[model samples]
Target: MKILLYFEGQNIIGKSGIGRALSHQKRALASMGIDYTLDPKATDYDLLHINTYGPKSLQMVKRAKKLGKKVVFHAHSTEEDFRNSFIGSNQLAPLVKKWLVALYQEADHLITPTPYSKKLLRSYGLTQPISAISNGIDLKKYYPDEKKEAAFRKYFHLSETQKVVICVGLFFERKGILDFVEIAKKMPEYTFIWFGDVPMLSIPAAVRRVVKKDHPKNVIFPGYINGDLIEGAYSGADLFFFPSYEETEGIVVLEALASQQQVLLRDIPVYDGWLNDRMNCYMGNDNQEFEQLIRQLVEHQLPNLSMAGFKTAQEKSITQIGAELKAVYQEVLERPYDHQIYAKVTK
Candidate 1:
């Protein structure tokens, strides 16, 4: 069956989690031998899978429904995840939640990154059928390489002996940027680098202040590094320090695992059943604990968690995710079309 996979406002999402997830999806679809198109107007496609809820996507959904095409909505954003994301995100979160609920209720099937996200969507009172799937990692793109590591270290002017702890995400409060800065302050000896974007005009004043003025001397905010350099950063860093307070699924964590870097993360509910504390990663509840864990990792008190994490990453590889997606599409297509049921449920 032909499928059209599309994300509205994709160009604007640049280097963000949503963009990365869409990129992974495209690769997965191609690997599975699935015939797919990015063009929404493509007539040959039997299914429309949308990954965003912008005005264009909403219009496409309505058009697809009218044409009797199977519709699948990929849940990449929720109200809870939007808070603290940008300048007005918190204020606009409730409205966004309402909009998402209305949009997702119209889908024939819904898919999210994790069970935690599924529960959150249900909490929003969406009764539509939902499935949890990983935003799987591309192992070939992200793996340990000494040559790349050396080049990265040389380019960044990082010394051979410096213990580099890195976090990759947009500079948002929900990502634990403040906590990361605090932890860096506590550990003056280690080099803390955050490789992500912080659009000066879009971020909140508080977050902007922190990114510009409040950070510790050792903390580095090299905003919006390219994909190849990011791979290099993952390979070169000693530990992937992600103190994010919230996430539907932390794709960077998986990338770090694929690169064989030890992970340190906040003990958040989103990682409930997936990341095991002290097994594949080190989890901390607060700043003090985070600092302690970092010290433990640096002083050789903790075992190498890279292998365990790598195994988990392997399990959630793009190839496996593609198979799951292909099966879901087949199951969806085999069933009878029921626009009446969709209309009733949406109403």
Candidate 2:
């Protein structure tokens, strides 16, 4: 079937998680030999896979449904994930959730990145068929590179004695940026770097204050990075420290794992099914625990964690994700047009 994989506000979300997700989906679809189009005017398409929940996307969904075309919505944003994201996100969350329910309920099928996010959508009163799939990583682009790492270290003027710990995400409270800074303060010996940018006026006042404040000498915020430099950062960092409070699925975590770096994350419910403490990653609930874990990781007390993470990442490789997506698409096409029954069966 020809699928129209469309995302609205692509320019607005540039280099953001949603943008990366759209890019990954395109690559995955192409790798699976799926015929897809980004053009909304394409008449030959059998399905419309909407990735954004904007007004335009909503209008397209309505038109597609009226035309008897299959409509699949990608659940990238939930109220829970929206809170603490920007200046008015918390105040706007309830309305956003209500709007999402209205939009997603119109879909023939729904796909989210994690079971945790799927559960959140159900809680938001969405009755559409929902499935969880990882927004898989490109192994070749993210794997370890010793030469790149060396260059990265030299470029940053980092000494070999300093163990670099990295986190990548937008500068938002929900991403645990404050917690990350606090941890950096507690561990002065390790060099901490956060790779992300903030839309100047969009961030909350509290988050902006933190960004403007003088952080610990060891901490650095170099803004959003991409291409070879990003790969270099992933490879050069000794450990990946992501204490994000929530995520549908963290693509950067997968990239770090593919780079064969040991990951340390907050012990949140979103990672319940995939990540295990001391197995594929290290988990902590608070700053003290994070500090202890970092100490152990840097001291070589934790062994084989990086290799284990790499192995875990392989399960969500681009090839595997492509196959899963293809299966979901085929199943949705074959199913009868009964939303209630489809929702019940998928749940």
Candidate 3:
């Protein structure tokens, strides 16, 4: 069957979770032997699989329903994502809410990538049939590559013998860039790198100038990197640090683990089943704990592939997740909906 996939935006395709999600979507479509397009109006398509609770995809969901097509809306975050993003203001709030509520009522299927997000979506009036499908990692693309790994290390002027640590995120308040600054100050010997560029966002012109100058050197903000370059960076790094205040899913943690590197993931609901303290990573409550883990990984000499590293690779790859998503879409198309509420499903 044909399918049309809708995302809020695919800007520059940076090294963020959304970028990885889109990559999985593209690769999975190729493997499934199904004809697919990004076009919302492709007449041959049977289903429209849209990601997130964003306004753009919400509108796409409404249009797909009007055309008598099957609709699947995946929830990547809770209602807080809706009220805090670019649409938080009064002018766009009603329009964004109107479309999101429509997706909740009219879409034939719903999905959330993480358990934390499943609870979040339920709070947004999503009472229809829904399931949890955790995000994916590309095992083949992300494993340890000595050649590329060496090249990346030489390029960054870091020695292969010295352990390398990486932190990647768009420079937003929620990403905790300032937290990294604190972590870096305490542990100066370990190499720390930050990926993603903040100027990409459409913030007010006035604020842009101030944020541009704030990028410091020791933190190593190298803007955006895509394609083989990303995996190369992952291959060389000894560990990945992701301490987001709010994230529905942490795809990079899976990438790092798949590449045989450790992760210091934030202790949150989305990361519950995956990360274990002193196992896959040192689960952190705050900056002090993050630093302590860094010291442990540095001084203690943690063993490589000690705690079911291959098992993690087996569980969270693109091939595995794509198969699960295909099942969800098939179920949505083959079954009839018991409830379809056009009015506001919740107060």
Candidate 4:
């Protein structure tokens, strides 16, 4: 069946996790030869697959339901992940949750990136069906590349002998940016790089303080980047250290794994089932633990789990994502359309 793969306000979401996830879904659909349209106004599609929680998406949901169309709402942003994200975000979190719950409750089906998120959404008292799907990775684009690695080092002016640790995310407190900076300070011998940025006005004052004035000399904030440089960062870096406090599912983790980079992640619920400590990757509970783990990795005390991480990335390949999405679409189409699902909002 044809689908309308829609993402509202994409211009505002540039290179963010939600935007990246939407791109992955498009590639997945293409690989499966599924007919789809990005146009929300397209009249030929059988289903509406919305990837954002904006006002436009909420309106589309209402309009689609009125037309007796199936709506698959992707639950990319939960209130928990929204807190500490921007200036005044924590204070606005309750309102965000209310809106999110109201919007998601109207969906015929909901898709989230992990079971942890599915559980979290259920806790919001949502009775709609929810499926956990990976924001799959493109292995071909992110695999090990020596030439790109060399270029990344040359461009950054990093010496070959210096141990490099990298994290990729927007300058959000929830992404553990403060912890990242602190950890970098603890390990002065290693060069720490954070490859993301947000407008200073939008960032919280606390995060802005650390990013602008308090960060140590060993830390480098290169702002946002992509293409060969980023791909090379994943491949060439000695460690992919992500201290994010929350995630529905981190797409960067998948990219790092696909690139065969050794990953170090904060022990968060989102990675509860798949990622194990010291198995496919390393895990740390806090900044101190993260520092200890980094030291162990540097000393060769920890074994190379890059190959194991690569195997995990393989499981979430675009082809697999496509097949799963197609199955979900088929299931959605075959199920009897219940007009009553629209009753809550219509009233």
Best by TM-score: 4
Ranking by TM-score: 4, 1, 2, 3
Candidate 4 stretches with Cα past 4 Å from truth are 343-347
Per-residue lDDT tens digits for candidate 3, residues 290-331, read: 888777775656654424654676687777777888888888
- Tens digits of per-residue lDDT, candidate 4, 173-284, equal 9899999998898799999999988888998788999988899999999888999999999999899999999999999999999999999999989998899988999998
Once superposed on the true structure, which residue ranges of model 3 sit more than 4 Å away at CA?
Answer: 12-15, 52-56, 81-99, 200-217, 301-307, 337-347
Q: In candidate 1, what residue range of length 10 has the lowest lDDT sum?
A: 338-347
lDDT value, residue 176 of candidate 1: 92
Q: What value does the lDDT take at residue 206 in candidate 4?
A: 89
Task: Give candidate 2 misplaced runs (Cα > 4 Å).
Answer: 338-347
Q: Estimate each model's TM-score.
A: 0.96, 0.95, 0.85, 0.97
lDDT tens digits, residue span 8-69, model 2:
89878757788888888888998999989999877688888899989999778867766667
In model 4, state the lDDT of residue 296.
85
Residue-by-residue lDDT tens digits, candidate 1, 161-232: 988889999988999988898889989999999988757889988788888988888998888887667788
Residue 46's lDDT within candidate 4 is 91
Residue pairs clashing in model 2 are none
Any residue pairs clashing in model 4, and if so which? none
- For candidate 4, report its TM-score: 0.97
RMSD of 4: 1.2
After TM-score superposition, the amount by which residue 193's alpha carbon in candidate 1 deviates from its true location, in angstroms, is 0.4
Ranking by lDDT: 4, 1, 2, 3
